[model samples]
Target: MKKIDAHAHLGYIGGWANVKMDVDELISLMDTYEIETTMICVLDNEVAYKAMQKYTGRIEGCVYVNPLEPDCLDLIDKYVKLGFKAIKLQPLRHAYCADSEIVDPILDKAEEYGIPVCIHSGHPPYSLPWQIGLLAERHPNCKVLMIHMGHGHGVYIDAALKMARRYPNIYLEMSGMPMHTKIKEAYDTVGHDRIMFGTDTPFHHPTVEMQKVLMCGVDEQGLEDIFYNNAKKFFDV
Candidate 1:
């Protein structure tokens, strides 16, 4: 099976414990795990885009944009031209919700480029599932992937499914949540085609997260779609 990890962090976040993995180390890990490709993003946009340039062919990435940054659009254009697959936003980190005025231009650019935008969803003390749905409604053409399905709060699953049902562009990425039965329920409710496999690696081991999906009793075809084909189709990988 061709494995594609839809989410991963490869650089250091300010003040967080160091997680600085160089391109060679990242490539070696991908090779060891037989990961055909990984979508790399960093908490810092400058560092992340540099990494994207360095690992251009072997990996794809999203530009990390803090909506609060005054030059957010310029940075977005820079990375978009550099061939980033999407924009990575962590609302919690910047204390800005997806619906904030600061984020409007970012969403506009995402629509303009026809690229997807991934948000760190389910991380509380931050944005919630309703915000994701609202954003989807506000930017009907923009493709949004909700990371972790709002992890601690399972309520986001319903919101994600509702938005997905209403809009063809919304997608749910499974990363932090570990309940196998809930994952299966999401598959049944939203259909396997709308779900993407993500390990949230470096935080959780890829092998272990991959195993969680494998043990879900989903048929091989379903597994194939979740693990690779769906992401391939989504990002044109």
Candidate 2:
């Protein structure tokens, strides 16, 4: 099956303790794990654009912007026109509530441009899964991907599942979840089409993440959707 990583980062984290991801390093890992494609977000828009341009189909760009920043919508439009495939909102990192009015414009632009918005989940008061669901409810036309599926915690997972079940526009990006049972549960509860596989690469090992999916015991069709088909449709790659 052709696998696409729906979530990844190409920048450093936490005072440069982690290695910064680059085109060669990302491609090397993709080659190692046989990942056919990846959707990457970076703090630097120019770096992301350059990486996408250099790697073309192998690395797709996800526009990362702070909603509170001035001309946020303009940047989103500019990057989308430049071939960005999705918009990433890190409410947790940006210190904003996902359901707040400030984020509405970002979500609106995402809908306007016909692209998905991937939100950081699990963190409460800011980026909770339920808060994202509330936003999804407000904008039914928009596609909202809950990255990490609440980071695999039981309480957050329950909230994520509840949101997924309640809102059809809400979808799950599986990564950083530590157990296969959660994957199986999500597949059984939310169905395969709404769930997409992701590695959260550079932070998590691709091989280990793939193995989690493999051990989930999903049927072949389900595996196909999670591995490639769902992301292909969602990201239009």
Candidate 3:
């Protein structure tokens, strides 16, 4: 029970790979990896809801939000009330700025529901760590997970850690990010409790993500906190 993947996907998604995944495939993968729980998001909210229903405890839903759409706010209200655990946003994919007021209403709704928020980080113009940091600054009451903790870039990865240090409400989920040493830097400086392990499934494999943390130079308890305790507590699953 020492693993909980904080960022994962369900259904077919149009991307570089146009990757597709069903619940059974995901469940089998989790079993093979010994992951106790995995938080999932999908382009279609129904898929997430159904998976949650089917698996009960194994699948935790992160209601995906696209702020550019008219129903984005309504979707939050709909899904959160339907038992989705947290809010997931991807600004770059939707062509919106993460720090803009367009996302404020979504953040407000998440606060109302008392759930944590996660946003895709790294990539320019929209999803940079500083941009997400501004949103966190505006809404101090909400918990925000900067997913990827700034992807594969060194500068963005460092920026991600800086944002966490700068904002108390900010937390980091290390998935696509490389650099295992930064995890140690983050744990030693920011706080081990603020960092968590994630596998951006269908995009990044768990082996590399887990290896990053394993080599991050933390103790056994620190590994437990990052792999399981932090996300379990943050998502309240």
Candidate 4:
């Protein structure tokens, strides 16, 4: 079966994680795991842009933006025209509520451009699953990917599933989320295509993430949907 990593980052990241990597490392990791395509969304659009331009089929770029930034609109327009496949938002990092009216413009822009919005979910006071649910509720037409699906907290994880149940447009990504069974649970209850496989590279490993999915009790077709088909459909890879 083929695999498509729904989320990843590139270049040097300083601060808490302190990790650095380029496309070469990403490609090598993918080759080892047989991941056919990956969605790259780092702070610098130029990084993802250059990687996609160079790798073409293997790397799909997602324009990451903090909606509160003044130039976010321009970045979205510029990157969309440059062939980016999606938009990514990190409300936790940017210190803004996910459902803040400030985000509606970006959601509108994503809808207008016909691309999905992948938002970081999990952290409190800003990026909870319910906040993303509110965002989804407000923008019913836009496709919203909840990256990490509420991170490592058990309560947050269950909330993530509940939020997905409430909103059809909200998709859950399995990356840093800890529960293996929730992977199957999400598919069984939230619909098969509503969950995706992501490595959260740098913060997590592909080997670990892949193992989580493999042990999740999802059958072959469900594995294919999570690891390959769902991302293929969402990113148009």
Backbone clash numbers for all candidates listed:
2, 0, 0, 0
lDDT of 1 by residue, 1-237 (tens): 668888888754436644456667777877887778888777666666676677776688888889887888888898888788999998988898776667778889999999999988875556676787777778888888888776655566666666666766678788887665555666777777778788776666778778778887788887888888878888777
> Where is model 3 more than 4 Å wrong at Cα?
none
Name every residue pair that clashes in candidate 3.
Answer: none
Note the residue pairs that clash in candidate 2: none
Can you rank all candidates by TM-score, best first?
Answer: 4, 3, 2, 1
lDDT of 2 by residue, 1-237 (tens): 679999998867765456567788999999887789999988788898999989999999999999989978999999999999999999988899999889889889998899999998988779888899888999999999999988857888788888998998899987987777777788889867898899887888888889888989998988888899999999999
Candidate number with the higher lDDT (2 or 4): 4
Q: What is the Cα-based TM-score of model 4?
A: 0.99
- lDDT of each residue in 6-64, candidate 3, tens digit only: 99998777757787788999999899887988999897889999999999999989899
Best by lDDT: 4
What lDDT is reached at residue 50 by model 4? 94
Q: Each model's TM-score?
A: 0.90, 0.96, 0.97, 0.99
Of candidates 3 and 1, the better by TM-score? 3
Model 4, backbone clash pairs (residues 3+ apart or across chains), number = 0
Per residue, candidate 4 scores C-alpha lDDT tens digits across 43-158 of 98998999998999999999999998999999999999999999999998899999899999999999998899999998999999999999999999999999999998999999
Q: What is the C-alpha lDDT of each candidate?
A: 0.77, 0.88, 0.91, 0.94
User: Which regions in candidate 2 have their CA more than 4 angstroms from the true location?
Assistant: none
- Alpha-carbon lDDT of model 4: 0.94
